[model samples]
Target: MSVFRYTLLASVVLPAALSTVPALAQQAPFPADAGESDGADTIIVTGRVQRLYRAEQTTVGKAAEDPMNIPQSVQVINSELFTDQGARDATDIYRNISGVSFFSYAGVTFRGFRQDQSFYDGQRGNPFIGFSVPQLFNIERVEVLKGPAGLFFGPGSPGGIINYVSKTPSDTSSLRMVATGGNYDRVGISAEATGPVDADGIITYRVGGFYEAMDPYRRNTTNKAKIADGAIAIRTNEGGKLTLQATIYDNYLRANRLRGVLVDDAGNFLTDIRWNANEPTDFLHLKSQAYQARYETSVGDRVTFDAGVRYFDAREAQKYHEPRGLDPANPDLVRREFRDQIRPVHGLSFMTNATARVDLLGMEHKFQAGADWYDEKNVLDSRILRTGVTSLSLSNPVYGGAAEGDAARAALLPFTTTDTRTKRQGVYLQDQISLTRSLLLVGGVRYDHFEDKVTTSTGGAVSNRSSYRDGDVTLRTGLIFKPLPDISTYVSWSQSFEPQAAASQDANAGGPFAPVTGNQVEGGVKTQLFEGRLQANLAAYRIVRRNILQVDPSLPPVNGVDQLAPIGEVTSKGFEVDLAADITPDWVLLVNYGYNDTRITGTVAGQAITNAVGDRFANAPRHKVGFWTRYQFPVLDAAFAFGGEHVSSRISLSGQSVQPYTIFDASITKGLGFAELLLRVDNIFDKVYAASGFSAQSGHFPGEPRTFLAELRVRF
Candidate 1:
């Protein structure tokens, strides 16, 4: 069988083994008699945990107990919610969280943080994006922690951090399978299972995998993907455990698009788009593999040690087509281009967490402490292409590519292509100190050091360019106060720093510049309501980034001479709100909103003058909003939901601006014995706007329009 078919068949068969667990696994137990708020009531997760109606004892035990104790603004997106929404990609799942937004660019932003600092499962995933690769199917939950995690993880932003929780061993045993298809002829299938392997019930394991593919919701675009993932865990009565997890994913996309520039009647920069939907075509291909092995053991009643090693490799290649005009007369022309990028990232992290209930001189307190280490390597090979010969320039607007495609496409010299490599490593530690029953203090710190190397290739020969080295210390501190059993409020301050790669843009560095450094300071409050059935959190932060990276306009393009690098600084500030609740049994609500005010705060010499449509960072918007909810039908045994995302207009990396647009989406599901069925709709309005462009204006690829998908999921 073809890989796609084989994937679907595996998904279908896995669930057959789990159905024996009984009908209870087929339908969630919380929907029945959900209204008795005070009776064996369900707790509301407030975007913190999966929107499940489970008590503290039912959820991950150690996890559920600390939400009210931490001072930082954090959130947990549960696994059940993943099933409830049938989320297909990381963007589909995380874009709904507050303080986070996936803008018009293919870039992601959290609060005011740039795309430079993203990680997966607390380990580095996409070194290029601010967030790591999308969470996979076996994810148990998603954790979003705000403020500098410098103390426990590495040098992370005070804005927040994201960790994809993998599904591990569980006492509950069951099997699951899923099949789906939708607009763009999109198709996906997958399955999973958990149970004891021995009659003694001393050992258990969970395993699953998935396959998916889809076409562009747009008329001339197509998006297809294939995925396979699984996990196995062995458990014993001593609380000792060892597990293995793996995934293989491949994605392909093609588009006949607009190149990266847009001009008005007089040919002045108006937007970041190149308005040519009909062209020679552009495409991107990506292949990724991630595997991890984890081991956990209990040392005593108060101490537990967890250690894991994860390895991930991703290779991506692209041919970007740039179409630079909007006047029907002058056809779009291809411009700036990127060739190859490969990231081989791996990390070995060992954490010793000791939690103990201690009588400290007459007062009872809970104590937790740990240490961490991380290493990352990044490699990028990029090329810039610009035709030496000028097109009609609209002087004679009535010229076609047929008239120009020959000479214009011919004069297009590969100009300059450069290869870059980055290496970073760090170590950290954290501690939670209790002062009183109602007042507890939290603090942690981390130190990091990084090394970067830049190499350029011309005619196939590689040459060394320059290198960079830098280090910094990050910190986090907070306070929590619980005046009542059902309520807890806290305030926190956090910080994070990016490498100095952009620093090369400093006037002192001359031509090629170094990486920039970014940092943030934030304070926020979190509260739980109605005995923790409902939750809400709000935070405000200021981010001061130095030597903001931007192309050096002064550095003219030369075949083997110089490269453009970030040459300025910009400071940004923002506020965020996150909420989740179970207003009543059978009804669940989730929402996240972010507001940002980012602008060029400082500029180097000649920067302000030459940059007419330049300087403002791309992929960032001033406002973002999203909401989703599911309401169950006790009698019909089903539920339906609708949710969508809205983003304000954004600026081009080159400083041009794109108009603002909003998208709406929704879905529905049904329950059956040992199975559940679902139907999902995306972009119901079929808006023909840009959902994502290439790094703030390379091409105008239409966002997916209205589409539909149906899924059959079974539980054993």
Candidate 2:
């Protein structure tokens, strides 16, 4: 069957499934019995259920407000949730969210847009090109705003935005220590401490750090990383504050990168056969340092102002092997070559916002204005060693073929050295009007300016220089209605733009390509059920994107890649539902489901494109589901948690099909005075599957096998 058929099936089935849940709740016997607020249950559940999948307030829109009133699809993952799940990277947390997935060379796919960029404290951060994953030890919480959020985040993927909030100092002093040892010979230690720096309570400080090393499940793979983060704040009695924060990250991975097994036509990867398609000497190193300063003060009772500045620097070096193709004479033999490269990037950002409340036309209104600017520079130095390990047999593999040393390395002087610089600026204004006692209107508009410069050199001689510039205005508006204090229903429309960094294939055209534009219309309902202990949200949305990059199929390959053109349009529509409940004081449940359908809608009339209209985007599964539940026994001072995830079949870049797969995980935790012990197991069923892959490439990444981890945590 085709993707459209499956999407149609889901569209019919999911709504029907949702309609029955409320009836089932009415007949169920648990919420009435467990909803009672006993002293014991309150003490135990308060530390667990209240913190899961919930945030009191967020600054995703430059305004702090309850997520239920945001008029969009938003999900918050606090430290407690990720800590319990043993999350280390984006993949771990995205699994619990609807309509989010990972892919190789694509970074992360949200909705139908490939998002390679993420934000820190509402500002742009370093891009993740699938080479290095960010650390989470110092993160206080993560907020994900779904759909077109360009009004606040400027140019980015239309799918949504992700913001990472760092931990800061508090009045109460606390310290925590954690030691962990897990499968794959993993062991690590981490520490976090925060306290007041002065007796008068005017100064406070916080520090957090972690170190870990492990041998991964993949053969000949080893990894190690170290991170440190610190912050300090000074406060005045008048509610004015000044803060400074800094962080350092160093990471190294010596393993087979971009190496995976080949799948059959049916998308079945042989479980017993596994080999590293790259040389054992392959490795990657990344180091970064960042600092920020922020100040906030109130001019009067109804007005406030805030400002911040941030700077970041990073360096990367890697040597790996990239796959070519299978030998024509031997289907089981795969061809590979060596790649050596280095990149150094640095950037600075400045932002400010002011908010005020006023009464006009017999109603009160809140208004906000903000502006932000960022400048970044990047340098890429690349080289190639073509004579390394060439082929590897799928059925059988042996070591000691190619060794790592300067003697075996050779530089390709013909390769171009590129230096790129980018500047982005945006100014936005927002207003919240209370139309009536239970009705509210929210709206915002942003004007953005973007420009880029590229300089290329060959063998120490300058070859070419190019510059491009563009600007756009984005808009957002929403309406929210509240029949009850805890129930909210809203509808929203938003716009987004993303500037293309590469030049167009048509040299005769005026200049670089125009930015891709996106717009979305969404409606949703959010409510607190069962006396505010259970939260449920349901949303439906449709997004249309124009000026998408497409390649001309009639033209021959250029340097093993096709020439690009920008004359494509695509549409993505989906329904999402999320539920988190403390269904009895001791029982917690989390469930999320997404039904997504994405397809190319338009292309040049006569020019053939690789992706035809009505074809689904590569690696975007139409169906995704997740379920997790936990139960705590107060008497035994213990808790048990289990969850499983499922994804439907996906289409690859080359139009190959990938079969659907599922995985399960479970964990147990016991409290011992000021310390706690946790035992967790992932991939409990030992199912063999592909986490992700490139359709046109030979890299079919195999999922990990059954693994176990044990952690001991203490607090003082």
Candidate 3:
């Protein structure tokens, strides 16, 4: 279906469904459940009266399991923490997670590797694609799963995965409205409501939407977004439940796809941080609609089954100017080029799983078996047109020189059109066995078959076509030993696989390459100190990636053409520490630190090409530290929060050095009966630093300067 049609249908259907539900009186707050269990009769009670910075369980493993029970490094940041901190998008919460940093728009440098894909409710497929950032209006929590997760998620980076758990329908009835205003002409409003559809509480519904508009810190840049989300749940007499959810997003960004400011060879900015190379008319736009349905039921007393299906359709387009290089005649002038691109993506995901609890021999086991399938088709059309005014001064600024309107587009030539399709299917089985009261074993194995095809055409004529099909088996095994009830020490080993391009630029020289594979060994200790008031986790790991494709340095060029080979290897070793403490009834603190070392380990031996064997990975910082603390004053009915992050120096992909920097933020919240007000200030010191860099020509992305935001929330 078209984006407009789907949006219109959802707009009509959601309100009609909600209108049928009768409103009820507000209910008192209750203990929040972490999530659904894996058919096991284990109940983990956190005993939290109010929202805390710590999370006890996660569903990233296809079930709700305590973080201590899982051997891998896992962390969760809930809605309360991000909301209190005044987070604007998903990237704003990265500081709470160890070993993570921004790579670009929606991507992150995770454990020395780049990761861009995200999961929703433990399912694969992300609606927010390309350069778009995901809004947090409908998110309940963000879960970070470190290391390889190939046992469940097929074809992914070896570093980790991020899961966005959405807010679902609840039995409690409530209405909330929020108004926000901030510096830079920022304004936003949102409303959310949830309640039961009938007096018997057999059906429930939730609907929410938000509209935001802002002019960013960058010159000639503006952002606006509108999002709508709705969900409905129906419970059967037999305890079976079905949930349906829909989301619509419309986003527009003007001159927001900037390549940052011009920089010299020494990484010094030659222009102001807010400098813009593109015209005010340049924009990036995205429109998306996603729908999902899930059904869960129990059989007998030990068996449970759940199934879900998700469909996502999105269109993303951008018109931007890119810096090519400095003019040879005049070093003070930079050459620019303009391009327009249109991308459309369609994705479908279906998953079903069953969990059974049984006692075999003298051991108790929780067994889970599942199968999942995903399919996606993405198409991109690109057009490039160069105007007479393609150079801009570095010291002085000028705008509105680029060509505009249909006349310019009509004269443009088609650069490239690429159509790519991907299909993946995997079946997995896992078992959590208890050998003794003090020892536990968790093991899983998955077999995945992946197929990818790419077709490239220029000027409506096919240029190159390539297809790849592969199947592999990945494994996960972890052993946990508990010496005390509150302390656990564990070791784990996991494997992952990712598909690579099947062909090289010279199709005849290098026809195909093998898929990349990675394995990691990790050991960690988890402790619940002071009667579960404090949670601490420490982990050390080493990951090795093989079958990496690189330019063949050992082989001479055939027909004056370079070929590619899969004979490269890389390694990443790191240690991380995360701590969360509810120091007192009115105070909470969170701290995380990460140290990583990533280097190329193996490559072809004749001559160096691209990078040396011992070179470190670009954009991977060696040290990172983050902390946040909040204290409430009961007498004043107010709370104050402070947070900061520090990142060490790093190298960019083009061999340029990146400077280290630190930034701080603060916020204050006051309670006023049924309403609450919050004031937040970010980058209080107005530190000038680069978040990341692309190249000397493109320069580095500048961090946001000092900003202020105020929000008021009312509930009824």
Computed on alpha carbons, the lDDT of every model, listed in order, comes to: 0.56, 0.75, 0.81
TM-score of 2: 0.89
* Clashing residue pairs for model 3: none
Clashes of each: 28, 0, 0
lDDT of 1 by residue, 69-133 (tens): 76666677766667667776567775567767654333356665544354554555542221134
RMSD of 2: 7.2
Which residue ranges in model 1 land beyond 4 Å of their true spot? 1-65, 104-106, 125-135, 156-158, 218-221, 254-283, 319-377, 381-421, 502-521, 547-570, 604-617, 692-701
Residues 26-110, candidate 2: write the lDDT tens digits. 2223333322134332212224644445777888886667887788999888888877777877677777888787665326668
Per-residue accuracy of model 3 over 204-223 as CA lDDT, tens digit each: 99999999999998878999
What are the TM-scores, per candidate, against the unseen true structure? 0.77, 0.89, 0.91
Which one wins on lDDT? 3
Worst 10 residues of 1 by lDDT: 55-64
Each model's Cα RMSD = 8.5, 7.2, 9.1
Question: In angstroms, how far off is 318's CA in candidate 1?
Answer: 3.4
Candidate 2: which stretches are off by over 4 Å? 1-46, 127-130, 270-274, 299-301, 387-389, 403-407, 412-415, 505-507, 510-513, 551-566, 605-614
Model 2: residue 642 alpha-carbon error in angstroms? 0.8
- Candidate 2 global CA lDDT score: 0.75
TM-score of 1: 0.77
